[model samples]
Target: VIDIFNNFALGICEGQQLDMDFESKTSVSREEYLRMIELKTSVLLKGALQIGAVLGGANEKDIENIGEFGRCLGLAFQLQDDLLDTYGNVDVFGKNIGGDIVAGKKTILTIETISLLGLKAEIFVELLQNKTLSRYTKVNDVIKIYDQVGVKQIAEALIEEYFKRAYDSLMKISVPDERKVVLIEIAQNLMNRQN
Candidate 1:
């Protein structure tokens, strides 16, 4: 428990630092963004699961499985959060959308869009930097570029992939099928949630 808490605390701090660093960067790779999210968000979830498994008298292998499952689920959750910030309905999403674009946050969607757009990404970056532009215009224009490159689809696909990997890890645990049912249902609900 002590070690888990320590690691979790350190991971969050490091992740936050990386996030700040990415803010000034012109371009951030998908891999780098994923790593940042994993450190910032996944580590806490992973540590909790690992600690729970240890308390439950799980073997080392089961603990590892739980960690992997939590890690993947955390990644999926963060991706979904990023998606919601841009694409979700304001009423259901419970917050103003497109905040990421306005803030110029380096989400997976933006990273992929920039990568696909190549040199043309400069135009998108300019839109983000243009202080005179209204919030509506900036967000609308960025979303247009995102839609042009099918970034939402790409993000959704990545989320599905992570969920699948998480499920695979969950299945490797030694628990009986009945014991796993609740977890499976929770995972499904998480994937389908609007907020």
Candidate 2:
């Protein structure tokens, strides 16, 4: 238990540090972004499931499978969160849209938008980094760039990939098929949620 908790904490800290480090850079590769999220977001879920499996007397194989499920689900969840923060309806999403844009957070959408835009990415990044721009204006400009570059579709596809991975991990577990139904439903609901 102590080991799990300690490692989880360290992983989260490392992920956050990477996030901060990425903020100053002009661009981040997709692989690097995934690694950061896996450490920062996935570790929490992985640790929780591993700890739970241990308490439940799950064998080593089951523990590994459950941890994989949790890790994949965590990635899916974070991707959805990134999508919602950019594209979701304010009323349904229960938070202001484009918060990530306002904060200049380098999400997958941002990276893709920059990569697709080439020279024009400088303008988009400027708008994001500009302290003088109103929040509404900054978010609006960034969203416009994202739309022009088809980032929403790209992000949705990536989210789907993670969802598929989560399902694959769940399938590898030795539990009866019926026992996995609730987990499947939860994953579906999470992927399909508006908020």
lDDT string for model 1 (1-195, tens) is 788889988999999999999999999999999999999999999999899999999999999998999899999999999999999999999989999988889999889999999988888878878889889999999999999999999999999999999999999999898988887898899899899
List candidate 2 segments past 4 Å from native: none
Query: Each candidate's root-mean-square deviation in Å?
Result: 0.9, 1.5
> Cα lDDT of model 2 overall?
0.89
Candidate 2: count of backbone clashes, pairs at least 3 residues apart or interchain: 0
Tell me the tens digit of each residue's lDDT in model 2 across 1-195.
778888889999999999999989888988899889999999999889889888988888988888888888888899889999999999999999999998889998998888898888788778879999899988888888889889999999998988898899889888799988988998999988999
Lowest lDDT 10-residue stretch of candidate 1: 122-131
Regions more than 4 Å wrong, model 1: none
Model 1 Cα shift for residue 135 (angstroms): 1.0
